[model samples]
Target: MTGTIENMIVKLTGWLSRHSIDVLRVSLGLVFVAFGTLKYFPGVSPAEALSVATLEKLSLGTVSGYAAQFVIASMEVFIGLTLVTGKLLKTGLVVMTGAMAGFFAPYVLFFTDLFPGAPTLEAQYIFKDIVLAAAAMVIGARALGARLIPAYERQAPVHEIRERVAA
Candidate 1:
């Protein structure tokens, strides 16, 4: 019984470890494609107003309205296609990182409105960019054959964790 359980656990971990990156990539791709498609139909996307407002504020009101939304939608679609197809993945991650940065920038610019006691609707919508950015980082690192964990964390030994736990 013990051996069977151990084998099953090991297989599960192996399967998950192997497929985790693909799962992240595909899910992110799906989200981007769905949201981007929604932007094409006016009044379909909940973020339309927030997007326009953020761009307007970012560009001092010069870059707002339908044009900005169209550009963002195009970008998202391109990123999604590239990600889903696993073609030009690095490029996709780069574009995704940039877009996420822009999406979240207004949070900082309008800190009081966004981060008071509770986040407003727009703030709540854009806050998910943090997770998207982190996911992009993970995918980017995998694309570049690099470690997702920082060098400091990588350098720490298993013994250190055991010692800390013992303490």
Candidate 2:
């Protein structure tokens, strides 16, 4: 029974490893596209105020209000489309990473208000970008020919191992 369970787990892990990248890309793309589109319509997006404020602060008051919100939303849509279509994926990943950094800034820059003691709902939502950004990095790295795992199993040579053991 234990052997059977282990076999099943291995098979499941293999399947997930094969498909996880596409899943990550598509799901993240959908989220970005949806949220970006929401920003275009006034009073539709819950994040407008917070996003605008963050942009304003980051821009030193030179950028603020609806204009900043719209600009950010447009960028999100562009990144989403690129990621979804697998067109210029590297660019999308780079942009998304930067955006995620900006997205996460409020928690640090406005800690007193955003966190106080525990995190606010808005902060919680923004925090999810950390995971998403990491996922994007994985996808991007793989797309650029990263070797996350060796294609074949590897073990140290017997003599090398013996020497180390002896030492």
Candidate 3:
């Protein structure tokens, strides 16, 4: 029974290892598209106000209100479409990196608004970006030819191991 369970576990993990990156990429894309679409409508997105405020501040008051929201929405949708199509992914990742910086700027710029002596709802929203950022890193690594090697495939060749030991 133990052997059978172990075999099942291995198979499940193997499947996950093979498909996890693609799944993550597409899921992140969908999330971006959904949230970006929300920003196209006023008062629809929970992050709209904060996002507009952040953009306004970041742009030195040059961009504000609907214009700021439009810029954010357009960028996110572009990233989403690239990720979803698996085309121009490198470009998408590059844009995503910049967008991530903007996304994180609020922590430094609005610490009090987000904290307010305790974690507010906006803080929780921003905190979730940590996960998004991590997921993006994994996807980015995959895009750059990095991969998750299964444990069985991670062992060095015997000769290589022996050579290292001799050295």
Give the winner by lDDT. Answer: 3
TM-score-sorted candidate list, best first: 3, 1, 2
- Kindly report the root-mean-square deviation of model 3 from the true structure over all alpha carbons: 5.8
lDDT of each: 0.77, 0.79, 0.89
Deviating ranges (above 4 Å) for candidate 1: 60-62, 115-117, 147-167
Candidate 2: list runs displaced more than 4 Å: 1-15, 147-167
For candidate 3, lDDT tens digit of each residue in 1-167? 87567566656666788999999999999999999999999999999999999999999999999999999999999899888989999999999999999899999989998999988898899899899899999999999999886664457575754453343
lDDT of 2 by residue, 45-140 (tens): 887888888989988998888898888899899888987888988888888878887888888778888887888888887888888788788888
User: How well is each residue in 1-167 modelled by candidate 1, as lDDT tens digits?
Assistant: 87566555545654666678888988888889988988877799988987777777877888778987887789899889887888998888888878887788777777787778888887888878778778777778888886334232356586753343343
For model 2 the local lDDT of residue 104 reads 86
Residue 94 lDDT (model 1): 84
Better of 1 and 3 by TM-score: 3
Worst 10 residues of 2 by lDDT: 147-156
Which ten contiguous residues of candidate 3 have the minimum total lDDT?
158-167
Between prediction 1 and prediction 3, which has the larger lDDT? 3
